[model samples]
Target: MPVQFIKDPNQVGDAINESNTKPVVIHYWNPLMGEESPFLSLFHDADENLGPNVSLYVVDSGFINPPHDPQELPLTALYVDGKEKQSVPFNVDQVRDLIFSAV
Candidate 1:
C-alpha cells in the first residue's frame, strides 16, 4: 500500500474504521518539518516494506480538519482490528520492530 494522506484527522472515524480489516499505522507529522522531515521518507520506506496485512496513514497536523490533538504531532499509533494496540516511540528500528511484533 502507498502512504495514505489523512487530510482531516478530526474526522478520522472512516480511517480508523478501515483499520478493522487490517492493521493501520498512523504517523502524525508536523508540516513545519517540511520535506526534510525524516518520518516522511521513513513512512515511504515502511509503506513499501510492510506487507498486505498492514496499511500506513500519514496525517499532516497542518492539514488536520479539526478536533484532533496537535500535541500528538510526531507520534505514531499502531492499531489492529480497529483498536490502537500501541503508541510507538520515535525511532526507525523501534517502529519497524513494533509493527512486525504486532502483526
Candidate 2:
C-alpha cells in the first residue's frame, strides 16, 4: 500500500495501535526543506525496499527551522507492533535490510 501521511503524535499513536497484524514503519521528515534534506534520499531508498507486509507512514512534523535542526527531526526507524519492536538511528542500507527481514 502507499505510505500514509500523519500529522501529529496522536495520529502516529493511533496508527501504531491500529496496525496489529503487520509491521508499521514511520518515516518522519521535514517537508519544508524536503528537497534539500538528506532524508529525501533515505526516504526514496526506503520506499524502494518496502513490501506488502509492511506499512509505511510519512509524517511531516512541520518543525523544520531554528530550534529544530533538520537533523533532529526523528530520522530513526520505528517498528511499531504490539509494542515498539526496535528503533535505530536511520541508515539507508540497514533500514532496507530490516524491512526485507520483516517481510
Candidate 3:
C-alpha cells in the first residue's frame, strides 16, 4: 500500500487503530533533518517494496513526539493489532526487515 503521511501528532492513535486491521510501519522523521533525509527515501522505497500486506505511515518527528520516547531522529516502529511490537533506529536493511517481519 501507499505510504500514509501522519499530518498531526493527534493522529497517532488513528494509525494505531488502523493497525488492528493490518500491521502498521511507522517511520518517524525529523523535518529539521532536511528534505533530503535518507530515511525518508528509505521509507519511500519500503512503501514500494512492501506491497499491500502492510500499512506504512510517516510521522514528522520535528513536529511531534512518537510513542516510547525514542531517542533516535529517524525511528522505525512496527505495530500490530493496535500495539507496538518493535522500534529500531533507522537503517535501510533493518527497516526492510522490520516491515517484512511484521507480515
The lDDT leader among the candidates is 3
Clashing pairs counted in every model: 0, 0, 1
Q: Give the runs in model 2 whose Cα sits over 4 Å from its true position.
A: 32-51, 62-72
lDDT of 3 by residue, 26-86 (tens): 8887777776447666667777887888888888755434445645767888888888889
Model 3, residue 18: what's the lDDT?
Answer: 85
Estimate the TM-score for candidate 2.
0.64
lDDT, residue 37, candidate 3: 48
- Better candidate number, 2 or 3, judged by TM-score: 3
TM of each candidate vs. truth: 0.75, 0.64, 0.83
Worst 10 residues of 2 by lDDT: 62-71
Measured over all alpha carbons after superposition, the RMSD of each candidate to the real structure, in angstroms, is 3.0, 4.8, 2.1
The prediction achieving the highest TM-score against the true structure is 3
Q: Residue 85 CA error for candidate 1 (Å)?
A: 0.5
Give the per-residue lDDT of model 2 (tens digit) for 6-84. 7675676766665477777665666674534355554555566665567777667743222235676655444545466
What does the lDDT read for residue 72 in candidate 2? 64
Overall local distance difference test of candidate 2: 0.59
Local distance difference test values of all predictions, in order: 0.68, 0.59, 0.77
Q: Give the TM-score comparing model 3 with the true structure, all chains together.
A: 0.83
The TM-score measured for candidate 1 stands at 0.75
Question: Model 1, 40-90: lDDT tens per residue?
Answer: 677677666775767777776554323345665566777777777777656
